[model samples]
Target: DEVFTGDERWRGLPVPAGDRFAWEPESTYIRRAPYFDGMPKTPEPIADIRAGRVLCLLGDSITTDHISPAGSIRKTSPAGQYLVAHAVQPVDFNSYGSRRGNHEVMVRGTFANVRLKNLLAPGTEGPVTVHLPDGEQMTIYDASVKYLREGVPLIVIAGQEYGSGSSRDWAAKGPRLLGVRAVIAQSYERIHRSNLVGMGILPLQFLANDTPASLGLSGKESFDIVGLADVLAEGFPRGKDVEVKATRPDGSGVRFKANVRIDTPQELQYYRHGGILEYVLRQLRDAGR
Candidate 1:
């Protein structure tokens, strides 16, 4: 009777309850499902994210499009090839847009299809080249894994409109998966920048013509964002300068300033919680109390 009354009340409301009102039926079905028998479920490991130390940035003339494409995908791309290699049914491979939900798929796709030449691979002086655990000239993805394994932090340096194009969350999600803790750029596209913050990746802006060239940063240099906790604790107000120390490949270091983009008190909460999803889920779980 309580269930029926709850359902009626839900349906009578102006806003649609959709599938939420079917929770009782769904729970019943889940209990009876064959695969529901004594399965061990593991919680997501949210505490493992440490601050990155070794920063790598690979971008080309069309870097923004590569990082966050405008739409869809062709069957011949690296992402498509990876899916095919894994025996994903042809239709299931789908568009890049559809596959963002899978971290493995998105990380493999990060620098796979970018037409711009990788700046950190061997035979380049642009930035220090990172050798992959694999013997190949390391792509950005490979190098990221190596750095992550070594317990080194990472940041991405980009030119104008760092994240442009579609509002797909994967554009930001992929970097977080790769262990990038921050991104410094000349400028950022609005939606992607917000998405980066949502994923708990610090989006920093370089002011006063402090381009990668001006700062002389290459892929080989490591970066440290000192006083990160202090900035977050004090509230990341606009015009707040966070110190970014860049170590060059030649063992020289340069110190530059970046503006913190954490614009609101709510955003600070998200950063403290590791991400927006974790923050919201924690809130929801607590609300039941």
Candidate 2:
């Protein structure tokens, strides 16, 4: 107590006088955000994702670093352009990790990893993806922007071991912001699967020996993940097989079985409510009332 309140070290520190820390424009520690709103405040249940367009088709071993990377922001990138619009110069546009407090920057930097190679844009490297049906070559962020504008839900088609790196929340958060409703992969890293559930994103796992290549998925297909809300509503057990159908534009498609990766009852509740954060906030709000 004496050391905390009466010590010379505490007193010698430059303390700004106030009940609250004064916010300033140049202070990188953002208080009143020049960039973002907090997570979804309105309590909403996780509804079934429908008619999701293919966002990206990636190969095995995709990592959290691919979802949200740490690197120099390119002047041509969306996040860089945003910072520049706000009068932040190119040098002031730091890495994604540095600007995480700013959601706008983080979301833009998502899938902007310098090494990310989206299979949809074969022979392309570094954040580029081919927007399906339209076939426009653009940045991943740009594709997501176009999808969002069209009210099209998004899904990521992947090879095995999706999200197979350090447990990073932004891997899930970034996808969610891009309107990704589900990730259909051959397998998932355990913690990343949970993170997906926590973020209200469905983690769908392919059946044994089946994969995007084996299933002939070109990543140009429109996918329907059926029996999510309905199965849950009808007392479906955890980890049950779900039926997924993918339809190409030419009226041809494939149907297959994928297990819902939601593991526990509590996680299911979080998924049902859109996310763990939203579920917790709603519970707190209800208790207060």
Best-performing candidate as measured by lDDT: 2
Candidate 2: clashing pairs of residues: 46-272
Task: Give the per-residue lDDT digits (tens) of candidate 1, residues 122-234.
Answer: 35532133553233454556567777677776777777776765566767777777777888888888877778888878888888778888777765555777666666556
TM-score of each: 0.71, 0.87
* Stretches of candidate 1 exceeding 4 Å from the true structure: 1-64, 70-85, 89-92, 122-129, 132-136
Q: On a 0 to 100 scale, what is the lDDT of residue 240 in model 2?
A: 87
The clash numbers for all candidates, in the given order, read 6, 1
Highest TM-score scorer: 2
Question: In model 1, where is the ten-residue run with the lowest total lDDT?
Answer: 27-36
Against the unseen true structure, what C-alpha lDDT does each candidate score?
0.62, 0.82
Query: Which window of ten consecutive residues has the lowest lDDT sum in model 2?
Result: 28-37
